[model samples]
Target: MTNTKTNYLFFTGKGGVGKTSLACATAVEMVDAGKVVLLVSTDPASNLKDVLESPVDENIKAIKGTNNLFAINIDPENSAEEYRNRVTQPLEGVASKGEIKKVREDLSGACTTEIASFDEFSRFVSGETEGTEFDVIVFDTAPTGHTLRLLELPAAWSSFTEENPEGASCLGPTSALKSGKERYHTVVNRLRDGSLTSFYIVARADKASLKEASRTSNELKELGMGNQQLYINGVFKAIDKQDSLANEIEAKGSEQLKSIPGNLNELPIRTFPLLPYNILGIDKLRSLFNPDLQKSISESTVAQTNTPHQELTGIEKLAEELCENQQHGLIMTMGKGGVGKTIAASAIAVLLAKKGHEVLLTTTDPAAHIQDFIQQLGELPATLQVERIDPKVETQRYTEKVLEHKGQGQSEEAKKLILEDLKSPCTEEVAVFHAFSKAISMAKRKFVIMDTAPTGHTLLLLDTAGSYHRDIMRNNMNAGRLRTPYMSLQDQELSKIILVSLPETTPMREAGSLQDDLKRAGIKPYAWLINQSLTLLSSITDPLLKSRASAEAEVINTIKTSYSEKTFGIPFIADTRLLPTLLGNKEKV
Candidate 1:
């Protein structure tokens, strides 16, 4: 039954939901069953190679052991380079060098990166894979927000091309779209055809993740990719009934499963149990396909557990430092999606607020659940307030502001074009960044804590900041105006970037990449936070839990040694129903 739907499988959801793992496991299973499989990862920050323990680069390569399995990682920058050449190669004879150079520069922006990546993946979706020989293609896509934008591109670009056939828009001349019309249309049709494609909305058994999954499911249905399934990953079920924390996590997972959204009830659902150790390498990944393999592995891992433990500094310690020093500045917690940045941010804000500091906590994350969690806490903190820099609201506000001021003397036709251009996704990034700048400006008065969007989008926002700094510097030729927002971020005394991540390889790898990106943008992170360290938990009898606890000792040690002065390890809590309690001293592990 699943074979017919195996031709094209798309695993998408919020970041850190184990989409890549599940996709790879499924592909490995198909390969073991003698079916040809091609696994393609379209995420710009892809960890496909790390997950597979093999090199999967821009060009497709065969898996080490599997004769019929192959994989590829689409490089967006390379794609943009190729895409630019395709658009400007023919103009060399007709246009001057400067003209060609300008065209290339225009194509080198974020918008072009997105379209180029889309163009590369569109070929596979359209069944235009010239060299690959495979029966099934599995796509491990980017995070939810980015994936939705990518999915919408075929129709969005198709409409723009149809309307402007010969006119130039964001991506250079409209003639560029002429050659790709049929291909884009084909990709659109193939995506909508239920028989040819299937999407599995992957999520965890938590309120925030489930809610995001439900929303994504509805949106996918709207896009006509209605043939869908749901996979609930990282479900924690207690092996020792007496273990209160494990039981609490188990009960919460069960409750969330029972309350599954009505819209998703009709779709088939699969649940994967949370493991004690990270699922890395071929043997561990293959264990996902065969449940019986888990127990033996768990037993072996638990038996090998022998690590010394020492007291680790946690968020409470950091809170003490902040309170003692009366720290007041911009506090930013950032990492890949689903890595518990929201929880970390909330904890910090709650701690500071309890210390009677005026803290304004906010987020720019699309899958934000801060308000929902705060509501669950029953009451608001007197010293703390929460707000979200909503992209849609900010974009609308920005558009109206522009129309009222810049569009004042324009003709109706000119005004209409301005409105249309404002609707582009690029405008939302700028608007959100504008809001971010405003938030940074508020740090002079009180503590400003910002929970940023996931890694990819956050990088884009920072890139916008970098570009804006260059533009303003070029125009003003003075550092006076730049001293406000631009210099504010670079000032360590005025701003602190807190990098958060799980102890697992993927999140840490991405966190390292995120740190590098921030450094490149001239923003240095003040600290590294290792969230949900099982090493901090009490002695565990359950084999799985014990094994997990043992594995975390090594990770925690690495963070402590490498970032001893600045690293903080936050233990995993059993219950998070009350934010205050969860982040309070009473619950300190």
Candidate 2:
């Protein structure tokens, strides 16, 4: 890919598949190949600066001590503010302040930020940057859901503009839409043209990430971007074949590969072996494509000795603490994608159900598989019910409710406009927020174990909660007597937030950032759960796997000291088909 002449390249897949690392490595490789390259990150939760070890912002800043390489981080918050000004600035003096305020409020959403970032993305692809000196442009996109939405917008916006010339939905006025239509259409064509663009789907050897990569593959191909390639990252290699757990890890990767989704079979596929140590700095980045370099890269990561399992609390103890002799409460497991939030929530839900508590295991993720995951246990307890707040189902329900109540007195033409406006993707936010708010209310009667969507979407839901709280305070006559969902989140007695993450460099940092965001919202996390740590394999004979666990020690200690009041670790278990044995055994705190 570094040697390809393709003008545009995009790295997208499930989160934690090493998308950022791979993208940066590609840029470095291209530069080494003497090709001037520009990299752009469209993820709202971007970590380009951390990966590059360079001070990157909205501007195209050159990497330190490097030539012919430049990068940009399209900050969504800043982009939304700029887009809001662009939209409202024109309406000034010609429109009422009340009308302008309403428009601003409408634009204050995660969806708007998505569209704004899409607009910036199109600017580069639609010939607006044709005269730039760079030879190629590479994009490191957000997780699967967000990337699909971003790619779909060009076609969505083009069709929307052509049909609804007199009206606009979140892309500013009709006049601007008319002007952007051609560019949007141009972007759609550019994406479809195989010679000009390539979409790389990065994944791990796990079923979930591979399944998502397959879905992303078909979705992007349907959007006219069929020049797709699949990269299976972090392939397991057991140094000690005699070790049972290590061989199981290697066997699982092989099994997953043999049955990879059908769609992936059609694309060009590549694989990278897993590294026991985290890759940082430009030198380690180069080691990705060079296995010889990787072997001799560092000896510091390895320890000369083995140690027994260290003393610490586990998930069983944490689950007990969450129940705390209470029947009704809200327990939220929040984290970035691929961090085992669902598993943590499930273990706790089963533990509580066995203890005679009525629990509802739910998820707000659009790509959720809560029911399937729970049903795998063969016979679920009657006390433990599983549900997923299906975004599509909730959106349809919310749309009908709106059309029935708000559209009843309007004319057919007026109703048509309202329905058209509802087609905007932003409607998903309002629909999901309604369901989220209801779930919070249900916790008052039964244990509501919510495995929330990834970090970006959860923050958006929280932002909506805060917005709704402010609206109620400003407009309601009985504000002092009312308690909103935001208030429920802030109440320590009613709600408990558990931060979840893998014991790795990126996941740990992202979890810490999430904790800070929660603190800013006055929602202190009850505890931190480091999922999939190597602590369970403390007795393993493999040197590479042991070193992996050694790296986790530093991160685990950091979480205990710097982030959470209480910390727990869920060890890596090879057999995920069966429920955890720890469920039946509660630990003493």
CA lDDT of each candidate? 0.79, 0.82
Q: What digit string (tens of lDDT, one per residue) describes model 2 on residues 1-589?
A: 6668589999999988989889988988888888888899988778888888888898888887567889998887777788888888889999999889878876776677777777778887875754348888889988888788888888887877777776555556645322478899889999899999998899999887898898899888788789989999999889888778889889888998999999899899999988877877777778888777887864555644343454568887887898887779999999888788888888889988888899999998876756646766877778998888988899999989988888998999889878887787777778999999999999999999999888877887888888778778767999999999999999998899999999887788888998898999999999998887776554677777887887777777788888878988777766646354445333421
lDDT string for model 1 (421-507, tens) is 665555676688789999998888888989988887777666566656665664585666456576788888888888888877788
Best candidate, lDDT-wise?
A: 2
The ten-residue window of minimal lDDT in model 1 covers: 169-178
| 256: Cα error in model 1, Å | 1.5
Query: If scored against the real structure, what TM-score would every candidate get?
Result: 0.93, 0.94
Clashing pairs in 2: none
What value does the lDDT take at residue 39 in candidate 2?
Answer: 90
lDDT, model 1: 0.79
Given candidate 1, what's the lDDT at residue 114?
Answer: 79
Model 1 ranges off by over 4 Å: 81-109, 166-170, 174-179, 320-327, 479-481, 484-486, 563-565
